[model samples]
Target: VFFFLYIYIYILRTIMANLHELPGAQADSVPSAAKTLVWGPGLEANIVLPARFFYIQAVDSSGRNLTASPGEKTFEVKIVSPVEEFTRIWIQVLDRQDGSFLVRYRMYATYTDLYIHILLKNKHVANSPFILNGPVYHEGCDCPQSSGSVWETHMHCPQSFPQIDRDLALYASVDPERNAQEIPQRFGQRQSLCHYTVKSNKVYVKTFGEHVGFRIFMDSILLSLTRKVQLPDMEFFVNLGDWPLEKRKPTEKIHPIFSWCGSNNTRDIVMPTYDLTESVLETMGRVSLDMMSVQANTGPPWPEKNATAFWRGRDSRQERLELVKLSRAHPNMIDAAFTNFFFFKHDESLYGPLVKHVSFFDFFKYKYQINIDGTVAAYRLPYLLAGDSVVLKQDSSYYEHFYNELRPWEHYIPIRADLGDLLEKIQWARDHDEEVKKIALTGQQFARNHLMGDRVFCYYYKLFQEYAKRQVTEPNIREGMELVEQPSDDLFPCSCHRTRVGDTK
Candidate 1:
């Protein structure tokens, strides 16, 4: 019996040795968890944003690269939060079919360390349980305060600013002979531009425009942003008009003037409009009673809401007039009307008997909300999306800063520039009740996630950070630019003040 056992062991050893000698043999190229490598920006523990990613390359036990896929199912990746041990964060592993995998994950919770477990064939890989130190973000998803140095180095949010970055580059690439200070002076429109300067995290503004109300709100937002985070010293022009100031020309140098909205031909750096009433007021450390009322009034649920699309705004565009006419024709499907009319005052009879202004929150009483551009991209779209109703937006060339991130069917239902498809789309929405409701919920969630007060400030902070990098010359306050002081605590009703008072106790 001992002699037979010895013979069997000898035969097994000889077969294994022969297999190792053969080229590309399965027995010789088995995947080793220890040899496999994982590395990328996503592996960084200081990541504050949701989207994080890393790459995994499979290697053999002999430390040789595998040329083909070993099957994605063979690898398992998980990101587990210590606070929520039972709940595992969902991770996506995309097989490259080339012995590599791309693993993606999103951090949903705040102030919780995460453990990343990477396993190959249920065996622990090299650096298997990676502990990621979470950040402590402020209320409303503000910048993480736990690591100031990390925030300074990574001075950007997860959102992409393609157009803004492009325009910044264009402005930065000015003629060497032309002075940077002269660029703002040459393009500054007295009726639209507001020159602003930041010094030691304090914001000061000088209005070149007639829109004092708009300028005040814009500067207030800047001041509020500085209070939340330390901004670099910089000075730039902001256009408070519906139209962008910079028109790109091959021969002429383009001045990088910031604006609330932009189109295909414009190169203005777009920022969030000051017209977002709730966000603007909250940023300024103030909240009006009307805003409070709107917050409390969430409107009815999907089933209880009126089964018609609703829109009430000033007639500023031809498409808006057409919407009113369509609503009059198909009153059952749409309830659109002009609250005020200046563009077509002569044709009052055609689209008249101006409807009284409806509270912004009341628009959510209907299942669908219509968002037609007024002059430029309608600033109300963000506020409209914050409601509990789906938005049927008209197609247009104009766009805000966050427009690129929004998907048509996923976040909103798109309607043509003409009202020809309005009725049909409304009917389609009615037929697919559950789908439209989901769309409404998604749009609302987007606004809650990206357009909140803190996120808005974060966007402003990031925009200026990119702008600062592109400036050929240092930003300094110029002649006639007045200092806009921060308002006193008693002047506005602030939620932060209450927190301070409670802390003192």
Candidate 2:
């Protein structure tokens, strides 16, 4: 009886230890193994959720870690629907301490590659360029074999899509008519943020030009992504070039564009790089100017008139003459070499009210500061190449100042408003994918000749082993991960382990 009781006690303890990590094991606790804690789509992949969602933190296997907040999405999580081409889903795992992730696999809008994480090894490259070709759900239709609609995934918009709005939409709608071109699409009645039935399953979006309302669904995938992005009325940002009569009239030098509609802005389906060359060509013609560039009462290094400056009118005709002198001296200054001076004379009229309200000081700082600050770690080529500045992360100080440290309503924006940036980014990807590929793929002769997906995986896997424990299970990686081992630490291992490594490798 004693022996039997002892044996039973031992068996019970072992069973308890094993079952301790089960779903209902300890209220609200999800174990490492059972928890499919996907964290990121890397730096470039995030539109709705930033990469910080997958930051790194660790605790004992017991899972005791104090968290700063219950949930804050990072790892650039975005769960999107399968709609257009080049669309994909990104994921990773986190420590759940501060909600930092260990590995992140994000979908690059242009590069159809996967960022896979292997245990006790480095990451492998996954070809994610292919869009969903499987049957998509319409809910409005029947079940599996029903009259459900399927997406062919042909839409491949650029990386940085411009902010879509009524003006822009209307512009695109009428643009084809304006240029007498063929219109390819019928405007869908899709509203942004339109909700759908919630079900827990893998959701993948196809491309940049999915329904406008689709952005609301981005956070639903990364449940931790809760920050709502309210769109800012940017009619003001667009009208910044219209200076009061002091300078030239505001003609759309920097007009909004739709990549789909080629240069003439027609609704012509374009290949990826077509619009990029056009945009770069257009921007090269115009330059960014600011208060620093503005000429003040005191002359700078050179006292000749700068074309652009602030003007104050005087009651005396003599003062008026002096103003004319200033304008004459700086004729090429306030306005460019090409405009009609009549626009400035028309000022205090069309451009005055618009100019008075617009300072741009606030906007410039945020554009430069926030964009620069947030993208510190990712500033490296993987996040962006040099040309695609829109998605290219700025500095983190900007992110800290604008987001973490700044008060509400001051340079404040939501994830939704980011749609503008999102579209623009997608456009950039579409436009500059080749240049980006060159940068990502080019390094040494080895990189040039051998840096395909598998080799890249091996290189990263070697790094992962040196830095962290990553295991490769995707079968694609099994051979690569096995062959490489850290040699410095172990000159030799036991014969059995060596044989095992030999067999596996």
> Over the stretch 1-505, how does candidate 1's per-residue lDDT look in tens digits?
9999999999999987788656688733467899988876466654333335567888888887775678768689877777765542446676644466667654333435667899987888888887767542222333323332345455445554565666565665433124335655675544566777786666767765456567876776666555445576777777777887677673576666778898877777888776663444442234432211233344765689999999998978988888888888889998988889798898778998887888787887899999999999998887777677899998888988889889999999999888678899999999999999889879876875666543555677778877776656566666676777766544222233112211333
- Put down candidate 2 lDDT per residue, 1-505, tens digits, no spaces: 9999999999999887888456434422322322223322132221211121122332223554322222323222333443444344345443222322333333323222223332211211122221232232211111111110111011111222122221133232222121211111211122111111111211222122244342322222212111111111111000011010111112321222222112222221111121222221122123222111111111221112221322322212222233334335554321112122333454424222222232322221111111211112111111111111112232221111002222222222111222224224333434554543333222211211221122222221222122111111111211111111111213222111112211333
* Model 2: lowest-lDDT 10 consecutive positions: 236-245
Candidate 1 — what's its lDDT? 0.69
Quick one: best TM-score, which candidate? 1
Question: Pick by lDDT: which candidate is best?
Answer: 1
Q: Which 10 residues in a row give candidate 1 its minimum summed lDDT?
A: 493-502
Count of backbone clashes for each model? 0, 64
What ranges in model 2 sit over 4 Å off?
Answer: 1-36, 39-97, 102-163, 169-177, 180-256, 259-505
